[model samples]
Target chain A: MIQRRHALTVRVTHWINAVALILLLMSGLQIFNAHPSLYWGPSSYTGAGPIFELAGGFPSWLTIPGTQWLAMGRRWHFFFAWILVINGLAYLIFSIATHHVTRDLAPTRSDWRSIGRSIADHLRLRHPQGEAATRYNVLQKLSYIAVIFVLLPLMVLTGWSMSPRLDSVWPGWVDIFGGRQSARTLHFVIAWLLVLFFFIHVFEVIVTGFWNNLRSMITGRYRIEHEQR
Target chain B: MASGGVLLSACDAASRNPHVTKVLSIGEFLSQHVQHAVTSRTALAQEFTEADLSPEFRSNGTDYPDSAEYRALAMNGFVDWRLRVDGLVERPVELSLDQLRAMRSRTQITRHDCVEGWSAIGKWTGTPLSEVLALVHPLADARYVMFYSADPMDDWGTRYYESIDMEDAYHPQTILAYALNDATLPIPNGAPLRLRLERQLGYKMAKYLMHIELVDSFARIHGGKGGYWEDEGYEWYAGI
Candidate 1:
């Protein structure tokens, strides 16, 4: 059976987000390489030193320049940051106006009841087939919701928190995360969490049906092999 | 910088291309405009209490001046040094360290944020840049206040320089800091005098006092950017 799984808006934004995220992560690590350390609270050189330290930072292959250039790193990061923000904003507004959030993403009462079975199914490497395959599972819906609503917005806010210019918008907004350095720490953590989500997302795609899922994201078309009765 | 690339070695040169840099500048331009539009000009950077002070502020970039003129002034405790205030100003006055120290001072414990993503909080006490501007009487043509430093950033003796627009130059927290942590400024931390631009990153705060020039534009200056780092590829507005 064939079905339309993703909207055109969704397909377009998915690719943009993928490209923007990859560039943002690479360039972000490049910037982090300059300092090679993370700290908590307000300041870094408090004599107590960094809470977590990486002597040489992440390897160059993982960085955008494939080398250490703080200035270039910043250039790549700030450039793509705008792209991601704009794309994400468009996706959010489109989703709200179309009620895509309620229709496709929000979990229903039945979905909540299926939570335990979904976990068992996932552990067994079993995926819903036929008509169910056309719709998101409860787990899928929850994960996407968390990433879109909770994590992504927090990442952007934490980023703004670290900016001295943005801090002028409200004198001590960064204190919500403890301080500027604390905000930095949270931003790093959220980046890794997003990375983790990427790996899991790809893994699920491969295990379930890579070609079908990939094509859906690319062309908004999903083909389902109907299960025999 | 010597480490080997584990992946994407093919694209290394792509990042260094000028065309790529030109493309990337769109965000920088947008960021500056967005920040100025969103935030009030008089808004202050967050300040901290004495308890939040860092034990020791790490000094990056140039620690000491290698120039003979800077060393001579340093050797004599900067008594002979005079801060020249000129350019787009009517008075064009010069003030000594003692004179600056005597000005009505403003003290605040503020964080120094570096472009490299490190921060240090310390108490800064100094003559506000506004006080100097008031004495000199900036002309209507003045748009930016350019700061010249003692340290030579290159082999050609192009002294480190930085500039701020009128809004930042007149900010209450923008001061020509002469002291840190209630003591005389140390050699490593821009001795005699330095700038404290609390709303921006560390590089904007030029150190090792020499001259303050109020100008209509910095386009004719070195590399046609506002500061040393700006000439070397860093963003001119580093409030980020």
Candidate 2:
């Protein structure tokens, strides 16, 4: 049966988030290519020996400017950063105000208990049947909660810590993250984690039911397949 | 999906074209405005201890001036060198290295964050630019302070230069540094003098300084941008 699934707000915000994150990652890579190294503590420079260094430049296909264009990369990064922050804020406010957080994303005692089983089911490529397909699995809810509440906020904070001016207003942020370089390293790591999540998310969409999930996200309508169990 | 296609195409176009970088300069303008709104005009950059200094502070961009005139000055240990402060000032003045050293000075250990994604800490000693500006007394129309360097950034003899707004100019930490690590400035590190703009990136701190010009606006300067790098696409307000 075809039914309403994602809300218009969710669908719109999801697309906006997807675009923003992609832009951020691309531009971030371009920015990183400017130095091609990551460090710890308050200070780092050439001959200081970075904790991690990316030898050779990131391929043009992956970076925004597609060359060593730090200036242009910064422009792209900062432009989209505002968009990401604003959209994320709107999403957070609307989700909480509409009880979307509590009703859909929040985990319950039963959800916690079912998580282990859900993992097993996911490992076995088992798709939920009938009505179960309409409701989010416990694992889905938990990951969403983690992404929304933890990772995204951390990304924003770490990103803020790297700013020279912002550090003046909130030096505590740099301290909290260990230092500017630490914040930058953490920002890079967390972004990669989000990239990992994106891949898995896409895979899940394809494996479970590509058109059904795609239609739900785009048109707010999902078709649930009825199968004998 | 349709909208996503449109969005992706737009991004693709932006990525492919170099001129798109100019179009995106509006983002820099907006960011600069927002940063200004949030940060206090007099907010100071973090200062560190002597122990925090890097083993080697990397000399960025042009380390030495290739110009023959600058070389002759360097050969004589910059004793004959004078930093000419002129343009839109009540009293145009030229102060030699000795004269600058004689002025009231400030010493602070601070971190220098380069736009190329590196940082290093070093102790700096210099006369506060405000004190020097007070000596010259800039006119009412003077809104920006431009630092012209002796270093030829390219083969074309285009001297490296940078500028800052009046707010940054008057900041306590903004100084004409002539010493590093309790010694005279090294040739590799903008010796004789350098502009220490603590709040901005390394590039904004013009090294190998030779001239100070007070201007109503930087629009008439090279490339009509505030600095050499800014002319090369870097943001003028690099507060971040």
Q: Candidate 2: which docking quality band?
A: medium
lDDT of 1 by residue, B3-97 (tens): 33433564477667789788988888989999999999989999999999988877888899999999999999999999999999999988999
lDDT of 2 by residue, B1-240 (tens): 565456545766785677876667767787788888988887877888888877776798888899899999999999999999999999999999999999999998888888877788899999999999999999999999999999998878889999999999999889899999899999999989999988788899999988999999999889999999999878998977
lDDT of 1 by residue, A1-229 (tens): 7799999999999899988898889999998898889999888877777888899999877898877888888888999999999999999999999999999999999999999999999999999998999888999999999999999999899988888989989998889998888899999999999999999999999999999999999888899887899
lDDT of model 1 at position B196: 96
Which candidate leads in DockQ?
A: 1
Which ranges in model 1 have alpha carbons more than 4 Å from their true place?
B1-11
- Which candidate number has the best lDDT? 1
In the predicted model 1, the residue pairs found to clash are none
